[model samples]
Target: MEASPILIAIDFGTAFSSYCISVNSGHDTSKKTERYETETVILFNENQEFEKFGVEALTAYTKMTSSEASRYYFFQNFKMELYNQKITENLMISTMDSKQLPALKVFSESLRYLKDHALKALSETVAESLVLPQDVTWVLTVPAIWDNAAKDFMRQAAQKAGLIQDILSENLILALEPEAASVWCKQLPTSGFIEEQAGILDKSTVQQQAGVQYVVVDCGGGTVDITVHEVLDDGSLKELQKASGGGWGGFSVDSKFTAFLRQIFGPVLWEIYKNEHPAELQKMMHTFSIQKCTEKEDIYIECPHNLAKLAAKNKDISSYFSQLEGACWTDGNIKISYEKLASFFTESIKNILEKIKEILDTPEISIDFILLVGGYASSSLLREAVKREFGSRYKILCPYESQLAVAKGAVIFGTDSKIIHSRVSALTYGINMSRKYDPLLHDPKKRRVNKAGDYTYCTGLFLNLVSKGQSVEHDEDAQYTFFPVDDDQTEAGFRFFSTEKLNAIYIDEPGLKEIGSFVLPMPDIRLGTNREIHLKIKFGLTEIKANAIDTSSGEVQKIKLKFMSE
Candidate 1:
């Protein structure tokens, strides 16, 4: 008898991570059985070896003595290291003690811990029977705004964690965070979400039926990922705009709070305290994080005794409070004024509002609702800010347990990858090719003479594969056939380039960047210039997939573009 198939979805976040599990019993694939979430933190012992992960890591590190913790390496919010970063296999991240560790080790071990935890939970339910790895499917969620290199790096980490046997394993799925949330939102009823106005019946906003258009703002700890979607008649979701956003997220508020702290304490003293009291600082920040999400007017954050003592060493602590504008030093606490606490969210909320307006201004999009999800979306200040700004024009809705939306949504997506019917291309993508030189259009500098010295070609001509904002169906492919430029060409290479500007004409344009490249071996020289390579790129999925077919030999090969060096 075949074993019951299990699906585990991991929403690996910057400040927090969560996993959701579902068992596919007959036709019931979306029934969630278990869900768990924890902080995205890891701690290493003095030997620089792995110690603990998630909540355990935070607790253990916090319990250690200052001298003992000084030698330990604790890492949190490390996911932001991959944002707009030049990712490579050798990338290293710094821990609390300013010690460096291979980024791959940290990511893989964190994932490994989550996988083991989920498996352990499954084991208990099976009653003395072991759950076979083959019966489990894993889905990992990443921000939709992340580049291909970052996504590839996460996949490599998952492989190293033994989540899957190989990169090409069918058991592993990479689901975009915003798209996953959109899927989860679609499955929810009108009652699942919280609206400032009670019993409001705006069809577009309240109803979850066809033709309802909304924008999903996945505000997580590291980044705010936004995407527009329209409900289709077939119950599938179609993306109206590509995923876009900035680093303005929940952590941005924390940064603002930290800046305030630095201003109160001199820079030198602050640095010393951060270095010496890293564990205490972490605990203080953790407390601030909780207070930040509470729906309260005036907030009081307990000051760490050590931080206050350190500040007192340099100057009068009372003088510092006297000069403070938005907060006062109270009984062992910092009594932050309501206006001051709101200031922490100002930058993040401003950026989010601006982006939302930009998306709404698009001529083609007509959104009636703004759906907020993720850890940051749960912030009361952020919610109030968003509602105050655009509440009149659009209905603002935030679901219960918004933090777990991504993880639960990922499970739904893993069960049905086709839930999102199409996606808009985020960037204009093209291949660099040599074309017959036209005197009127081709640049003189790009003109190249063939080895035969008879014909001239433009070396940096852009062969457009997809344009920015173009909607592409999920399973559809953009096919193109190309012939060797030279008769004796030993290989045909496809150099991929992308740019934010839609009107880029050349591969070397100012904004154009060479992202990746793949080379196809042309073993059959007899075909000469007549040999043709058929290339197809799937642009609608979360990650681009490409394949090449040699017509002469009917050989098809999957093309994995080489990114940065290992």
Candidate 2:
């Protein structure tokens, strides 16, 4: 209890959440809420009230109409919303900010509380302890499907919390979620588990638990992320592709379940459900109502068969639960059976597994086992559905703290990268576009450039040499040399290329696919208009710097691509 720890793995998940400290325990013992942890988020409010978190937060917000509890419950895998501008709000709007707090802020506040709790726990345990760990590093897990902006937002929230709370001496950062699952699962297998197929843990254990070549349909609170990984040549593991990111997650699933309940029971005894949960009825309609994608399934509030039956003018909501199990699932009102839930999941698993099959068409990219990690991976419905789609040819792996696996694995990665710079690598090239000059501008020369003249045709990636899943990274400068394609036009009038739609080429059957691609700057060029173009790429932490020069003429210019900094 004397030495304080420097790093902690934080799995801030969708449904349930947990964290693991670097310190390991021996034999059969308690991991106490202190050493290793999970929490039902009953947050302490400014007024010293123990507010809701976890499943409690869920039920509370579901019945709420006020924005406070409703807004705090952004269950969209809040971590992933950081990068994108457009978002769908199925949940009611509420937040500390009267104007509406961004999802990330609410998420941060939750973590801030967790940090405070951790600090208090540490202090309490060590009555008069000396020699505590000097550094404090956070290894935070996020959904693998999250984009840069989502990740950026998480980093920002972490920084704000770290600064505002003054809770740590230093903060080293490591981020990854599903990838961490692969690593931790490989490490925490049972003794009898086979090693040859271990992702990071044991091969046999995976087979006993998950299934082979199986796709892990991790339906969590915010988003469902599917990862397909292959066993490496040395029997290690390598991620092949991110199969899917969906709106279908635990909260969504529960919401659907809730609606289905009311549909069947709305005419029966609603008192039981209401008594068990006083605000249950309101919770369903206002905050966390059951939602459906089916065109046929129209959900109506639970009401007694007659207003006078309950000796009241309004419907007796208590009658709802009596018929909760009577839902007509074919109409999508509720999940009628385990089979039905499994089938619902089966379709989604098939959709993503089909994509994985396409990507791994090459035997070189084949995966042997599917790894399952996340709160909802514990679902009996999802587990069997995954087994059905991707059967026994490959094994499936699941970890104890399945939801927290990513964060823990992130910590392990952080440990490695903290010692070696090359250990932590990323793909970086400014997102750019192609432009057209006065002349020699092919494609859409006469196309009207908009008022911004910051036309889609004028800005695109400078160099996109790094593709997803590519491991070509170093602390070294991102340098790429591009001689004009034609090389003989007037100072190749350089125009970057960007369009409402990205141009991409295909790669099936010896053809090209235009998944997405943009033109680099439209270079205004002539035989000797410019001898050479010198480009320097600089990225320090969260900043990007690009310096371009006409070496022949000694003209230098720097491009600030960022319209507004994060």
Candidate 3:
């Protein structure tokens, strides 16, 4: 391997995962392989230790007998559990069998498996030299809509996996999944994308031109993350609006399919079968998953032998399915009508299209292109839905191998972090503080008196640092000055709050939420109330960073906000 730094990007998606390796600036093409991604599935032994990952795990579990499989744990689609939820260091996640295990253990062990696999691949590619952990820069992809707590949880998981020694090490970078996709899409010409308009002659990177704007709709397996970007004058990218999305993704369609099966098999029998024959259920879903992504025509899924045996106890299996709509039983396979199959994607496609319209509806924001990326973007059903709704107004483009875009672009972002110049603030951030009570502006009920009874202060005041919808650059920071309310106070606590409101007034407002907090030590009380503490908060990156300096002792304290614990 070359002495130059090597970059490895890991796209840990909900349904599937993939990684890419690059030496210096280009890919390390020492070996040729057709597979670009694998199932995000893991299997653990009876002792709760990691056994297999990805395809191997799926295969091992599928081969095991029902009795033998019950002793072990199989987990898939576990990544989505961290989204839109309160995360803690000791959070526990349940396996498909409803077995409990630490979330940290599951995530860290999975990451460790990927790390070792990548290193092994690199070693075989270059026998002349060995690659060390320090020689490679790691990039992890995460959804842009994830909160600070979720992002922090991923960093801690990476550290626990031995990817880096320190939590704040520069060697590990968290690349927003949509942003990574944007970076890779910008380097391609119009012809590189799928379903381009007819007779388009300009072949250069049309979206790369200065002032060109586009919307990145990352329809992953778990969630769809949408963001608007514009090319800066210098060719870098800038976010036009904050990322907005929902739980609408490819998995939603899968859920509908599961429901449809339940309808055919009767809810009581289906529930009982799910509890008794989980392995068979998993196998059936796995088959449906592959067919849903492809197969535009009628789809046939083989019914598990156990499920068929159980259904026969009540009545003829063929007679049972005949009563169902758009389903037929023939040759031991259940055939699904194409119209009924397309209906599975109705909710996801509707939500995605509506979100894109909402973002483009912003005043002064004219989008020239719409880019679809991620694993779900490969679905022919979703492609047609997006094109039908906005194809006439904007150039809808999906790059070749759209699923690999995030992983490959993450490698490029790891090499150069300045490709994204700015980002839009998703929420208003501020610190909860108390100031001198103002009779005119402060509510009398909120007024408080100190122990000394000499000063009157108002509690629950929200000191705004950054407002929602504000454009912030990576280097730009919001600074504020604070002082102790009591002359003899030896420490101060900083509480961080966020809300969707553009300008919040109080910390206890209806929509505001206290995310994390940390206490800063003020060992020196000699300066009394005159001591000045400077707090600086930096945003626009994958995670928020905060630090404070005490002018009296010239001490700098790095802040890692603590979230709610279990």
Per TM-score, the best of the predicted structures is 3
- Model 1 Cα displacement at 450 (Å)? 6.1
Question: In candidate 3, which residue pairs get closer than 3 Å at backbone N, Cα or C atoms, i.e. clash?
Answer: none
Decreasing TM-score order of the candidates: 3, 1, 2
Instruction: Kindly indicate the candidate among 2 and 3 with the higher TM-score.
Output: 3
- What tens-digit string does per-residue lDDT give for candidate 2 at 14-77? 5456665554322111243234454333333445334655555556555453334323322333
> Model 3 — which ten-residue stretch has the worst lDDT?
27-36
Q: What is the lDDT, from 0 to 100, of the residue 291 in candidate 3?
A: 93
Alpha-carbon deviation at 138 in model 3, angstroms: 1.8
RMSD of 2: 10.3
Worst 10-residue lDDT window, candidate 1: 199-208
Our tally of clashes for model 3 stands at: 0
Clashes of 2: 70
lDDT (10s digit) by residue, model 3, range 1-566:
12236677889999999988766565322333212478998899999989999999998888887788888888888999899988888888987668878888888888888887887787777424787766778899999999878888888888898887888777889999999999988887777888767743244775448888889999999999998999997878999988989889888998999999888988999988877777778898999998986667889999998899999999989998776788899899999989999999998898898899888888888898899999899998898888899888888899998999899778777777777899999889899999999999998889998766788999889988888999999778899999888888878888999888887778888999888887778889897889999999988776788899988878799887655454
